[model samples]
Target: MASLLYRLGRLSFRRRRYFALLWVVLLGACAFAAVNAPEAEDEGFTVPGTESQRAFDLLDERFPGGNSEGADARIVFAAPDGRKVTAGDTRAAVERVVDEVGAGSQVREALSPFEDDAVSEDGSTAYSTVTYDAPGEKLTEDTKKALMDAVEDGRDAGMTVEVGGSAVDAGPEFGGVTELIGIGVAALVLFLTFRALVAAGLPLVTALVGLGAGICAIMALGLPTTTITLALMLGLAVGIDYALFIVSRYRAERAEGHPAEEAVGRAVGTAGSAVVFAGATVVIALAGLSVAGVPMLTEMGLAAAGTVVIGVLVALTLLPALLGFFPQAVLPRAHRAARQPTAAAKEAAGANETTGAKETTGAKETTGAKEAAGSRWARFVIRRPLASLLLSVVGLGVVAVPALDLQLSLPGDEAQPTSTTQRRAYDALADGFGPGFNGPLTVAIDAKKADDPKAAVAQATKTLKATDGVVDVSPPLFNKAGDTAMVSAVPSTGPSATATKNLVKTLRAEADRVEADAGASMLVTSQTAMNIDVSNKVTAALVPYLAVVVGLAVLLLMIVFRSVLVPLKAALGFLLSVAAAFGVIVAVFQWGWLADLLGVAQTGPVMSMMPIFLIGVVFGLAMDYEVFLVTRIREAYVHGERPAQAVVTGFRHSARVVVAAAVIMIAVFAGFIGMTDSMIKMMGLGLAAAVFFDAFIVRMTLVPAVLALLGRTAWWLPRWLGKVLPDVDVEGEKLTRRLGADPGPPARTTPREESVNA
Candidate 1:
């Protein structure tokens, strides 16, 4: 790996201009393709074999007129004074909206609620159903613009107008503001860490180039999945992080007195190798999402995994090329001045130098200046490993406590901020009708087997109405063929409410009972039921999915570290960090702790898909710090030092770079909270917390303690296993050996003659 990286660095440096032009042309092409690519569709989460899916299939089969496979929306109208929508003026306004919206070429039909007594009892609100020819998510940009414009026109007529439903809410928006904020924060962190403008800007430039290309690639592929937002988010964060890691290591190597080209090679050979492994771990974790067997998730995982791969490749190749052009300028002015001696200082140093006295004094000063703080931290933790371990555990436990009560559900409009028109429409419908009116359950009754179709319909209605949670059951609407009919049943609770989910299960169970006696088959489905199915599937798959990812991570770590205990410790720390992050999500988004301060409008269950995505993403991300820190410690251990001393020395070398990388990652992820989408916000906060805790608490404190406590056993491996496991030299130890450089503690003191000659 070291030799390969060295060659790569030399090639990149020699062919820097060619590489630069190549990347520019490639990114330009990607941008062009992305501009021409079709907009992504929101393929709602689906488990094909589930009961809700079965019902949906039956409906689409038995009744073709309803456009059951397409999108449905509701245009809600309300008066300012809570006056009845049935009043003359209000009714006229509603009629005009229906007419304008229904006349659009995109709409298949618009059904007025006034004709069907769908208005509220107080007459304060009414809504019309607008069915589009295509699935709402697949609607063209022009069609959406037309629909929104029509809906907006209603406000001019003195009516409160808002549109709700999956279709209306699925329109895509940008996180440009959030992305800019994240970039700014990341820039600040890089500048402070490097204290060099050129050094700080390099990582950001590389990251942006990779991100821009990756996003365009995703768009160009036009994968029949909803992964644009996820791809962009992952691409941006990982791109920045990968570049930061490599660049920081490169700068450190330069400070160690290696020439520009040699520094780049050593940095790429060591830290760049670590970046590849870290990026692969993340990609593997995301790709593991395909095991859940959901098409949407599978595609999303692939899309994100591909973007991460791009980020890694760019960091490895293009960054090296870019760095070669301005190696001298990469270091800060102060750093450069420090490396070169002034004439007066050189003369004074020569006069003071005698025997080896000056050499020994300089070594001590170097150690004191460079190793004081990190060494102190390492020694402090090592001296009281038990106490350190206990404190770290206690801190993580406090943050994880809220996870015990974590509730998972799809984020409905009720959880959305009130600033959105979708939320306003959702609120109006719930107020005028009932909470369940927004997500009514559709019961598809197959009556061909029953002795009497009418008898089956009547029996099913009676059974549903008798169910404890049923709020209202609509009369049966039979298909023209008379072989099937559908019934709409609203639950007593809101769509995302726990009670509503339970109601779905209860009704499905009762339908089985009804079918047994009445010789009929009933399949219940709706947006709410489908959401419950997705949640249930994810819940069932969580433990197994985690087991797969953790096992893979452990195997990879063991190969790299060649230690049983090290991998186990890393995996455990990862779990603790993820749990703490989830706890934060539960407390803020679920328990409403300081939610208002964050601009969250309503507190509810965490998004159903959050845990699955978070576990995969955060676990992979946490490993990044582990790889950086542990590799350095292992490098020291291999070079000859007591286990305890090695831990301190290695940590002192790597802590700064690891922490800076984590801060950059956290900033990029947390920036997503500024997005309009609630799901994105939850994801941002969860990921930021994961990186924060993993870097500060786990890697900084707990890992050192555990390594200290284990002593020599921390590096132990069976002879057979050692021979079987390939050596993953992530720290360029071989290169140091080949170059005949002192890989151990910095030479205690220079030879007397060498010191005097200086």
Candidate 2:
């Protein structure tokens, strides 16, 4: 693999123009395709094979022109203090607003509060329901304007009015501010790491180019905006990091006296191999989302995987080609001067053996000093392996304690900020009508098989009303054919409350008894029920998903490191980091710990898909850090360095770049927290926290400690297993041997030196 990559890198560097032009053409074509692609439609949250979904399908079948795919608005009206909404002018104002709303474009109908009995018991507040002919995202600006105008009129009439529901929902706000901030921070980190503008800018340039192409292709495929946003986030992050790794390697090779082309080849052969392996882990984890059987999550995973693949390709091909164009500029100033010595100066310096030897000694001393400083943290962990391991494990375990109380639910209007009209309306309805009034379950009764449909419908309604958690059951409304009856049941608890989830389960359980007695089929469903079903489905899939991801991690790392314990250690470390991340998410988002500091407007259950999604993403990234750091250690050990010395050498070569990459990843993920959408915010914060735990705590601290304790056993594999496992030369061992490069000095460590230096 290294030999093949080495040849490819040299070919790309020699024919840099052709590769550069090819990428440009592809980017342009993708952009054109994106511009011509049809608008992407949202598939909304739909979980098949669930009772709630079945009920929805039944509704679509029985009522062709119903509001199943359409939008709805609830205009909540609150009277002034000492006033009743049903009194005189207040009543007249409510009726006027409902009439105006009904007259708006795309509005199918708007029921008056008085006619629907939507007035509060005290008559202090009321609400009207407006149904639209299209989905919320498809509603015209004119229609939204008309609704707002009517709301303004009601307010002018001495009433406080707010519109909530799907019709009034504006969807997620994404203005690119967060992405820009992330990119900016990444640029700063790169510049600081490289200390050369040209070198730092190269990674950013390559990343942006690859990201643009990936995003444009995703757009061209007509994926939803949310998917594109995710692709952009993952693509930019991995692209920059991959390029950074390769570029940093190329500079290190050049600093070691390799010429431009050879340095590029070695860098691509070595760092590029690690990049490919790391990228595969991410792709596997993300694409594995298909096993969850959720269409939206599947799309998200696949899209992100594709973007990461593109990032890898760009790093392997485009980045090396770019490096070939500015070899000297990419190196540090000191290295550049040493690399470009004039023939006369070289001849004069070489004429005196003692002078040349002194110059060489000085250079080695300077390099040694840098290595010592870089490996300082590794040395600390190595010296106190047991204590370091214990500290990391205990600290992470403490953080993970909060995850035990994690609760997940789909975010609803109640989860929105108080500043949003949806939240205001939700609060008003809960205050005036009831908490359950905000989310009423619709029971679909199929009575066509019953001898008497009306009697069957009546029996089902009675059964629902008798349910413990049901607050009220509405009169059954039949379809035009009179074969299907729909009953609305309001629960006593809020939409996301635990009791509401229980209510859904109880209703489904009671359906069997109702069917036996009335010979009718009942499907309990609603937005609330669907949310419950989705959360349940995600939770059920978590273990299976974790199993698949962990298995993949073990298998992949075994191949990369060629060791059983190393792979096992990597997988366990990944789990620890993920647990810690989940703990932080639960504490902040669910328990409301430091919620105000993080700008959380309200706290409830964590988003249903957060845990599984976090596991998949963080697992991939954790493997990335693990592979990059450990592959170097394995490389040093393979080259005949003692296990202790190899640990120091690996950290000396890879720690700075790994830390920079991790910081870049954290910056990108953290940017998402700035988004106003609660789900996106949660995703951002979770990923950021996960990267922090994995990179700094697990990969940096725990990994070295564990490796030090294992010593030579860290790289061991059974002879039988070694023969069975395919040899993937991720460290460029074959390339180094083929080029006849010196494999560095041999290790001669005493027991005391091993204990102290390791």
Candidate 3:
């Protein structure tokens, strides 16, 4: 691993011009491809063999002409003075807009609210439903342009016009304000951490280059539906952090008196290796989403994983090559000349040669020169390992309490922010009809086996109406063939409410009873039902997915560190941090503790996909800090320092770097908290909180205490296991040997080093 990074570093420096030009041309090619990329299709995710899917299949088979593929668009209109919708003047305005929309292209059917009894009882609000000929996502750009023009006509009239529905509300906008905000935060963090303008800009420049290529590749592949915003979010976070890690190391090496080329090589050989491992862990965890057997999740995970792969490659190759281009700009001027002798300093050195020699000897004997500011704190924690352990546990425990009450469900219209027109349309429909009006369930019945198909339809309708949760049951509509009938039922509860979920289950149970009594096939299907089905499948699959990720991570860590306890400790701490993140999310979003402040609405259950995503992303990120911190500690341990002193020294050196990298990630993720979409906001905040806890509490505090408490046992592994496990040399110890600076033998029985203790 170290040899590969070292070779890459040497190659980058050797052919720096070619490397720079290669990246520039690649970026240009990707940009050109992005401009000419084909439009992506949105084929929504579904869990096969679920009841809702079964219902959809039956409907498609039995009723070929039914409105299954297309979605209805709702045009909401209101008078500026709040005049009654039925007023002659308001009616004329709304009718004109409705006429314009109906006359527009792609309209399969247009039902005026006035003629269709869709007006509110107070007559202040009315809407028109327009059904398109094709699926909402399949609408051509020309059709969208025409629709927007018709919408403009309504707005031009003396009315407040808003449109909502699948055709009009194409999810959330991606990579505009949110993307910029994230980049701004990342740039700020980098500048503050590096304290050099040019040094800070390097990571951002490389990261953006990598991000552009990643996004362009995604666009070119035309799998935009699976991962649009998410891919961008991760690409930015990982790319910046990956470069930051390598740059920090490179600067550190330069500060320690290494030449520019040598520093870059060692940095690449060491930190670059860690980046490779960390990035691979992330990619593996993300790609593990395939275990869920959902196409959308699979594609999204793979897409995001692809970006991380690019980030790793960019960090290893492009970053080194770029650094080589302006080696003087990689660090501060003061740092670059720290080891050089000036004229006056050289004369003073000659006069005080004996004094200078003694001072140098004292500095070599003392550890204070090498100790970081955080080392004192780390040493203090080591002294009171038990107390530190208890405190860290209690702190993480408090944050994890809310996770016990974690509920899994996909947010429906209720989850949409109130600012959106789709949400307003949802609220209008709920206000006029009922909450359930926005989430009607379709009951499909195959009654060809029944003695009397018409009678079976009547019986099922009666049964549904009699159900406790059913607020209204539409009259059964049969296919032209008379073999299939469908009924639409409005529940008494809103879609995301607990009562609505119960209602779904209740109706399914009753439908079974009806099917048994009438000898007909019956299935319940709806947008809400499909979401519930997906939520349930995701929830069920989460455990296995986690098991796979955790198992693989543990195995990988064990091999890398050659320690059984170390990996277990890391895995456990990571899980705790992840739980705390979820707990914070549940308290903030689900419990509505600070939903107003955070701009989160539609709070009921956390998004079903959130836990799955959090596990993969958060776990991978936690492993990043784990690898960074633990590998340093292991390096010290292999060099024969006592466990406690080794931890203090390792923590002292790696603490700031780990914390800085984590802050960059937190900034990148937290910047998206301002997003309008509740799901994206959740993801942003959840990831930020998870990284924070993992870096600050788990890595900084708990890990050191545990290692101190365990002593040498922390590095223990069975002889058989150690021999079988492949040596994943992340520390570049082999490179040290080749550099002729290898420390001979482990100080197995040497007295405790006084320098390490202080």
Candidate 4:
């Protein structure tokens, strides 16, 4: 693998223009395709095989346009204190608003509060319902604006009015601010890590180019908007980090006296191998989302995986080609200055051996000082391996304690920001009508098997009204065929409440008894019930998903590291970090711990898909840090360094790059917290927290401690297993040996280093 990569890298560097032009043409073609592609569709949250899904399908079949699938809005109006909305002026104002809303484009009908008996008992508050001809995603901007404009009449008449529902919801307000912030932070981190403007800029450039191409391809495919957003986030992050690794390795090789082309080749051969493997791990974890059987999640995972693949390709091919264009500028100032004498001597001596020896010696001394400084933290951790391991484990365990109380539910209007009209409308409706008013469950009764359909429908309605947590059950209304009946049942709690979930379960359980007694089938479904079903489905898939992802991690890591314990340790550490992240999310989003500080509108349950999604994403990134760091250690070990010395040697060489990459990922994920959508915000926070825990705590601290304690056993693999496992050569061992560039003897340790390592 390394030999092939080495040859490919040299070819790219030598033919820089051809490779550069090829990438440009590919990107341009993708952009052109994107422009001509169909618009992206909104994500659908249907959970097939669930009762709610069956009910929805039944509605679409029997009721057709009468179902709740079409876009609809509830415009809530509140009069001033001591004033009644039924009064002449208030009633006139409400009627005027209803009329204006009815006049909007694509509006099927708008019912007045009085006509629907939607006025509160006190008559101080009322709400009108407006049904649109199309679903929310199909609603034109003009129609939405018209709906908003219609409410101005009621507001002008001294009545507080807010519109809530899918018709008025313009999916999360993403103005590109978050992406800009992420890119800015990533660029800054790269500059700090490289300390060379040209080198820092190169990664950003390649990342943006690759990301653009990937996004264009996704757009051309017309995926969901959410999928594109997720892909962008993952793509930008991995792209920059992959390029950073290759670029940093190129500089390291140059510092060791390799010429420009050879340095590029070695860098691509070594670091590029790690990049490919790391990328594969990520792709495996993400693509594994398919096993969950959720269409939206599957699309998100596959799209993001494609983006990562593009990032890997760019790093291996485009980046090395770009590096060829600026050989000296890509190196740090100190390295460039150090190399000037060597360049001059090469010119003066015409490849003389004496000058080359002096150049190599000077470079070695500079590299030695840097390694000693970088290895300090590694030494500190391994010095008291047991203590370090215990501290890290205990801290993460404490954080993970909160996960025990984690609750999962889909976010609704209540989870929206307080400033949003939907939230205000939701609060007003709850105050006037009931908390359940916003989440009424629709009962679909199939009475074709019954002796008398009307009697069966009536019996089913009575059964629902008798159910616990049932606040109100509407009169059953039969369809044209009279074989299907629809009834609305309002629960006594909010949509995300535990009681609501229990109610859904209870009603589904009661359906069998109803079928037996009345010979009619009942399915309780609504937007809220569908949300609960999706949540339960995703939650049920969590354990199996974790099993698959963890198993994959073990198998892949075993192949890369050629060790059983190392792979097991990596998988366990990943679970620990994910649990810690879930704990933090529950504390902040569920328990309301520091909720206001993080701009949480209301605390209730964590997003249903958060845990599984976080596990998949964080697992991939954890493997990235693990592979990049541990592979270097394994390299040193294979090169004949003692286990303890190899730990120090690898840490000194790879710690800085790993840390920088982790920080860049953290920054990108954290930027999503600023988004208006609660789901997106939760996703951002969970991913960011997971990365922090995994990178700084698990990989940086726990890994080294465990490795030190295990000593030579850290790299152990049974001979039988070794023969079975194909060698991945992630450390470029074959290439190094073939090149005959002897690593030389381990540097003699200083007294301070010896004491730390003792």
Candidate 5:
């Protein structure tokens, strides 16, 4: 890597513009390719007999001709006063909504109380039982704009019309807003950090290249995937991350008097390896979500992994090409006075460590230049390892106190953009109708083989009405082919609360009891049932996912560092971070701290599987920066430095880079909270906080201090085990240092390094 850096440096001195042009050509080609990218239609949500063949099979077997017991969307008409809206004004509004409902362009169908006897009796408000023609078809930008305009037009009409249903409430605008926030935040962070337009542009460029290439690749990869709101942000983040490491390295090389090309090569050789590993870590972490037992989550994992793969390749190739192209931009501005080393500078570089304040790196020549000037961090971590760890533990513990209060509700159109017609109708429904104004659980009792599905449904209806909060139940919506009857179960509370949980419990248990007494098999299934099953699936898979993540992290660390103790300590440290994140999630979301600040409905219960999900992802991210830091420390240790020296010194050099990268990510994540959807908001805040606290407080502070306390023991291994493991070059430093020391080589000097006549 060092040799590569030096050679590239030489090339930068010779062919700076050529390198720049090469990158320009390549970047243009990549972008052009992306613009012409083909679309891939993957299985997301499938309609019974549309393009998704599998969906048809499932529908035919499980829910043919619509499962009456399945969930349905509700649309309502309302007055502004928040009461039973039944004026001529409300009637006109209701008619307008109905007009849209039967349009077929907006959805599969919207069946309201006027259309279905199951909706409501003596209703001032109507329900729109909607189904979409294409569940996975993204609303195009123009369509979303038109929806927004139509809603404004309705308001102008002064009829007080609001339209919402299952498939209409949550539309594409929410997704777009979320993406915009992420991009804006990331852009702001990079601009602030870089301070120059070019420098700022560089990271964004890398992000665009990586994301564009990844999108095209995903389209071409023959995977069952479609574009999502989160896709662009995820791609940009990973891309910027990859670029940051290389750019930081380039800057470090410029400090060493190496040219841009050399820095690129060196950066690729060292930071490139770390980027690959970091990308892999992310892949591993997200892969755990594949086992979330939802086809959506499984698809998410695959798409996320595929994006990372594309990012890694573009980052490796295009970045180096860009570096070769823009030597002047890559290097810092030069000045005549700044050209010479100070008289005392040479003395500082050659000095050895002595009885001093604290030791960082044993490589005095390299280490002294990199330390954080006046770092209070070192004093705190080194002097009080246990205390630092405890502070992080307690702080995060307090934050997670809300995890016990977390809740997971199925994302719906009501969570969509407030500006859209669908979302407006949903709001209208909720205002005039009730909490289940959008979509309520429909419990179907399977009496398909029974002589009397009507009696069984009546029994199920009685059981549902007996439940404390169930507002009403349908008598029976009998299927022609099967002796099955569907019954609606509406609750007073929203779908992601303790009330929802209680409702599910009551419906299943009471209906089962009624069926047993009636000598019938009652299958209670609905939207609520699907949600219940999904939550249960997440719960079931949590343990295995966590085990895989932790075990793999430890093993990877062990291989990378060649010491069990080092990896063991690293794993424990990461575990601490995960626990801390969990505790905070519980405390804030479950317990409801500043939920208003977070913009959630309320803390429900930690999402049934949030802990497991957060653990895998945050652990891998924590470990990535950890490796980026510790591997350098290991390099110092391998070169005869003490473990304490390695930890402190390595941290001193890498801390700023890692922190800068982390700050950018935090910004990107935190911005997500600004989105309208409550679920996305929760996820945004939770992940943002986890990364911020973990990266800065836990990984940066607790990790270094603890390792310092352990001293040489942190790197200890049995002699026999050590003998079996071959030494791998951490930075190719041995050969570089040897070349520096060898008397056989000619003495090195450059035009910039020549001594004056004085």
Candidate 6:
């Protein structure tokens, strides 16, 4: 591996045009792929569990559920004070508002206190319900505003009004604000780190290609588009980032007077290994998410894994190819005199030593980066591996303590960003009536003669009382003279999922007892109950799902690295990083540390699916750094250097590039915390934790520290294992040796002993 990086690096110095032409070809292919990317079906999303979804066509007719599709919007009318109202003017004014809102005829059911039979029993405050029958399962803005304006017009008529419901009610306006922040921060860091207009833009170009491909692919696979769309953006960011680090390193070699071919080869040999490792790490980390047992979460895991794999490939191949197309004008002038960076230049190569390594004609030792980076990282970790590791351990421990406190929330359109009228209506009702008003659990009973007169309503009443969440159990009342029984169980407050689960537990238990006692079967189903069942089903399937993914990822890495331990060790590193990241999220967000500072209003437990998503995403991303760093070390080792020397040398060479890459990622992820969207903010915060830990703690300190500690065993493979395993030179060491002039072993750094006198 070491000889290959050295040789290809030398070859790049020897052959420039060949490499440039090759790059042009790859870019053209990716662009063609991008151009051919097909449009998705209706924004290209499919609802999950569609094949096995409960067949409720019968229920629709049976219950006619009188508009039970859930509320479309809620209109709130309040007086300035909280005092109960007996005023006729307040009522009249509210009626006028409701009339105006309902006048558009776009909605099916517009209910309000001002409307007949719709006023609150106390008449202290009022509300309006806006129902709709839309093609895409949501009311249009035209209808939403009519409802909103009715309330607004009432404000002038001595009533204060608010509108909230539907998608608008699901989340806050700043819901995706964190995403914007993360992307912005990432872009800024990319710009600063690369210090070249084209270089900075390179990731964007390849990422867009990969991302467009990912989107098209997933859409073609037929998955629903929801909050999970956030994954796409994140995937693109990481893909671009991974490519930027490698190509920039390669470009630096070119600027240093090496032919583009050798530079490309070296880039692939050292940074290429890193890319492979990062890809493996990502695959392992995300594969775990597949095991989380929730189909929704598993789907997300698959999507993320696919994106990383495909993205990395593009970064490695397409990005290098695109960079080869740059005109000679893009290369910096010879470094005899200082040169100011233009935006274009800055986007390609930051004025850092990462670019300067090329000045040695892509040679190592005197010019080798791994040794320098390794030494610097060793200085930090050797002195304080314990302290740094401990801080990560302790902080993560503190934060993850709340993971035990995590509870799942119900999913809804209202869970999306709330810029729509339905969301506004939902908020109005949640705020005006009660937070629980947004969602509640329903209990449905199935008996022998569901709607017949012979059904025993009294027995069902007794059955419901013993139910755990029998908060306000109602006596069974039959639609057709005591045949079918159904009751509604409204949770006192909060997301409906948990409350539904509890109610299902209580109902199922009582139903079992009744059946055993009376020899009659009954059915109990609720939104919450179904959701709980889904959770259980997902959990049951999580382990096997994870095993398949992890196994595959490990197999791929092992094949690439030709060492079982490398794959296994990388998996372990990814785990710690993810664990630490999760712990921080729990400590800060769930535990409510500086919630105001972060603008996280809800301190309730994170969504049930969040942990798996975060862990997978973080693990995959951190592996990116791991891959680059380890590859350099391995390359040095294959050069016949002793393992100890390899560790030190490899660390020096790979350290700075890894650090710079991580910093850019950290900035991008962290910057998104300030976005207006809550979910986007969560993503930013989680990624920020992952990136910070990967850079300062994992890649810089822990990884090098461990490799130094591991000696040759880090890449050990048994003779028998070697016989069975196919040798894969992800960098083609044999091919490199045969093809190029040797750059020679990197010159050893001047010792501190000799430096003082020099």
What is the C-alpha local distance difference test score of candidate 5? Answer: 0.58
Candidate 2 overall Cα lDDT vs. reference? 0.84
lDDT of 3 by residue, 1-758 (tens): 88778778867865778998998998889878878988876556567869998898888888887755676688887666657778887788788777877786788887888898878777767888888988777777887777677777777867767778878766555755755776787788777776677878888888888888888888888885548677777888888888887887777665444556777787898889888888878988999988877777888899999988888888888998888776766565554343453444422322211111111111221244434545666787889999999998899999999999998777766777888777877787777677888888999988999999999988888888898888889888899889789999999888777787888888788877888899787788988898788888888898899899889988988877889999899989988899999999999988998889888876788888888888988888899888888887777667666777777656655676677778888888887788777778888999999999999999898998999899999999999997899886787777767775743222121122122112
Candidate 3 Cα misplacement greater than 4 A, ranges:
77-94, 114-126, 134-162, 176-179, 338-370, 741-758
C-alpha lDDT (0 to 100) for residue 447 of candidate 3: 93
The regions of model 5 sitting more than 4 angstroms off are 1-59, 62-74, 79-124, 128-159, 170-201, 220-227, 257-263, 334-371, 374-376, 411-439, 448-469, 510-520, 579-610, 719-728, 731-758
Question: What overall lDDT goes with each candidate model?
Answer: 0.79, 0.84, 0.78, 0.85, 0.58, 0.57
Q: Per-residue lDDT for 1-758 in model 4, tens only?
A: 78788878887887889999999999999999999998876545677878888998998899866765578999999998899999998899999999999988999999999999899999988999999888898999999989888888779899999999889786644435775787788889888777788989999999989999998998899987778777877898899999988998887776666667787888899889889989999999999998777888889899999999999999999998988887777776655555243654333221111011111111221233323444777888889899999999999999999999988888899999999999999999999988988899999999998999999999999999899899899899888999999999999998888898899899999999999999999998998998888888898898898889888878998999989999999999998999999999999998999889878999888888887788898899899999899988888788777777777667767887888888999888888888878888898899899999999999989999999999999888999999999997888878887787653323233243234234
Clashes, model 3: 1
Clashing pairs in 3: 85-123
lDDT of 2 by residue, 1-758 (tens): 78788778887887888999999999999999999999887767778878889999899899887736788899999999999998998999999999999998999889998999899999988999998888898999999999999999999998889989888887655435876788899999988888788999999999999999998998999987777667777888899999999888887665555566777788889988999999999998998887777788888899999999999999999998887677667766554455254444333322211011111111221233323444767888899999999999999999999999988888988878889888899999999989999889999999999999999999999998888988899889899999999999999999988998888998899899989999999998988888888788888898898788789778988999899999999989998999999999999998999888877889999988887888888888899999899988888788777777677667767888888999999998888888778888898899999999999999989999999999999888999999998998998777788687653323232243234223
Local accuracy of candidate 1 as per-residue lDDT tens digits, 1-758? 76677668656765778988989999999999988988655455567878988988788788886635577788898877857778887788888888888887768888888996778878888888888878876777776777788787888878888998756765554476876888799899888776778878888888889878877888888775357677777887788778877776676665555556666777788878888888878888899987776677878788888888988888888888888777756664544455443444433222221000111111221344333355668888999999999999999999999999988888778877898888999998998888888889999999988999889888988999999988889899998888788999988789988898888888888888888988889888987888888888888889889889889988888887889999999999988999999999999998989788766788888888888888988887888788878887887788776788877766666676677778888888888887767888888889999999999999999999999999999999999998998886776777777666543223221233134224
Which has the better lDDT: candidate 2, or candidate 6?
2
Q: What's the best-to-worst order under TM-score? A: 4, 2, 1, 3, 5, 6
Candidate scoring better on TM-score of 1 and 6? 1
Q: Give candidate 6's error at residue 516 in angstroms.
A: 4.2
**What global local distance difference test value does model 1 have?**
0.79
TM-score of each: 0.91, 0.93, 0.89, 0.93, 0.79, 0.78
Task: List ranges where model 4 is wrong by over 4 Å.
Answer: 172-179, 338-373, 741-758
Full candidate order by lDDT, most accurate first: 4, 2, 1, 3, 5, 6
